[model samples]
Target: MTAALWPLQQAVYAKLTGHAPLIALVSGVYDEVPEDAAHPYVTLGSITEDVDDAHNQRGLEASVVLHVWSKYRGFKEAATILAALDTALDRQPLPVAGFKDVSVAHQQHTEVRDPDPDIRHINVSYRVWLTKS
Candidate 1:
């Protein structure tokens, strides 16, 4: 069976960047944040994948993390961005390369206190299931 992590990440990136509402809320969606990256942006975080094989077919389950960063005074800014991110991916149809029957769902999320008091962060996770095509 083929590895689905890269393709899945690409698909998620495309979905978030291409969504008008989501894009309007953030500077950009990035795999690697730039040194001069702006505030109120989204970054793709770690991924964990596992084998979930079924009779006569190969399946994979992946958990992807997305981080929302904002310099806004309160958690409200990060939360709004989180909502947009969730709406963009949760239960949304994603077309991943080399994979079929793909589905994404919101797993869980939490607020993280950055050491730098000025920064606010919200970490969100999504569960993705796909079958090798």
Candidate 2:
């Protein structure tokens, strides 16, 4: 399950960010989101198991992170990225039984870092839930 979920999260990141390098740079950003997002960054950042019970009896929990940059910082870019992510996930081909329930509990811009005082790094996090189909 961890192996499968990791790839799914990567796909989500690709769909939202549209670039590979940017995603790799700020993987830690995903940890900042409120717990409500349900592993939102799963699509973008590396996944570390927070809690897992045998046979997924208690389900799985993971953390995700993503970083982005732009001349402008606002919701337009965030919204667009999120929308694209949703579309991408919807179009994905699930396993034979498929996913029963998938939910994103939170979405927020957790941080803005300026290295040169001119360039900004935008970090976003979200929580996601996946159930059997």
Candidate 3:
């Protein structure tokens, strides 16, 4: 179960970064956002995984969260980015190493106004199910 997590993350990162439309909207996608990272960027958030074996096969269900940050003065920019993110990820094929029957789906998302007032945040969650290779 643990083994599949990293590969899944790598696959997700690759998908996001490799997507031209999404890359054009943000500075970058990151697992760890740098201190001086620019606005309108994406950062990988929390992930929760659980064992879900069946029929003698090892399976796992993972919840992945991604955050979109923008200081564009409104939610429009952030919302656009979120749409691109959904386009890049929702129901899309993710090629995770050492895993098969991989599937990804958009679970939900929330738009938020940061306390800073100048910032807009959107939390996007995706559900992934995979069987060990």
Candidate 4:
């Protein structure tokens, strides 16, 4: 079995970082946000994979989550970022290094009011399906 997480992530990163709308609206999208990072940025979050042994092919299905962090004092900015994330990944074709027919889609999302009150966060989950080449 092969893990397609890295490849999918790379494709997604490229999409988001290259998007002018997303870039202009937020500080940036990151796999790991740096310390002292500016507000209004997106970060890659947890990923869970489940083995998918099919008829004769080994496959994998994964749930990947992303977090949108903002300090805009309201949900507006966070929602905007979340929309961009959805546009970038939902039903988008992701090219995985060692896999073929990779597909990713927006699964679910949640808006949370952080305890800090000064910050807002939205968590989005994506479902990915891929088969070994």
Candidate 5:
């Protein structure tokens, strides 16, 4: 699944649970840039300055994390939910313009098995970072 979906999943989960969710962003520091880019290249200088300012004003940087759990029998269902969430986020407008750079920092999926297990669970975690505009 594409990395973009975590934020959307977190948003949905938060709405359902009425609590903060944990998500993992899965992007690398040196990931290659696409051959065809639409926007001007962003530099660390701009990102750092903006994040620092935002942090100062908010007293903390803004971020979203999502943790999803489901029975092993429903692993595919869970994945589908996450994928749909990603697509929704891509098509939707940001809640605020301050979120300029929304990127994935890490992602992980784990499964547990037990011989006497009545039901298995699949867990997906996502972490994301955002800088205020």
Candidate 6:
């Protein structure tokens, strides 16, 4: 059985960046958080995988976080970004190497007003189910 964490994350990156509308609205999508990045962009956050095996099959429940950052005046920009992200990933088939029939579901999301008073953050979490091929 192969672990699908990195493969799934890569697939998520592909999905997020490939969406034309999302790319247009945001500055960029990234796995690495760059220094001095432009506002209203998305970045890959944490990926935590756990065991979820079944009869004669191996599976994993992956918890992934996608963070939306904005320096806009309010939460609307971040909320819009979150919507695009949900449209891109929620209930979508994410292709992961060494895995078959990967499924993704939107778990939950949170919006945070940064103490800096100049930034807004939205964190979205998704649960991915991957079965070993």
Better of 5 and 6 by TM-score: 6
Q: Estimate the lDDT of model 2.
A: 0.44
Tens digits of lDDT, candidate 2, 1-133: 4333655455454444554433443232242455554211322445443444447544344444555443344435444444444443333432312344444534455545466554444455555445543
Two-way TM-score contest, 3 vs 4, winner? 3
Candidate 4 global TM-score? 0.92
Residue 59 lDDT in model 4?
Answer: 87
Candidate 1: tens digits of C-alpha lDDT, residues 12-101 = 999999999989988889999999889999999998999988899999999999999999999998999998988889898999999899
**Candidate 4 lDDT trough over 10 residues, lowest sum:** 3-12
Q: Estimate each model's TM-score.
A: 0.97, 0.47, 0.95, 0.92, 0.35, 0.95
**Alpha carbon lDDT at 63, candidate 1:** 97
Q: Tell me model 6's lDDT, rounded to 2 decimals.
A: 0.89
Better by lDDT, candidate 4 or 3: 3
Q: What value does the lDDT take at residue 10 in candidate 1?
A: 91
Winner on lDDT (2 vs 4): 4
Query: In candidate 1, which residue ranges exceed 4 Å CA deviation?
Result: none
Clash count per candidate: 0, 16, 0, 0, 17, 0
lDDT of 2 at 132: 43
lDDT of 1 at 110: 91
Where in model 5 is the C-alpha error above 4 Å? 1-65, 72-74, 89-98, 104-106, 113-116
Model 4 lDDT per residue over 81-122, tens place: 888887778896677788877788899999999989899999
lDDT by residue for model 3 (62-90), tens: 99999999999879999999999999999
lDDT of 5 by residue, 1-133 (tens): 1132334344433433331121222111112335553221210111111233343533123334333333446456446545543443333334333455554432554554435354343333434455444
TM-score of candidate 3 relative to the true fold:
0.95
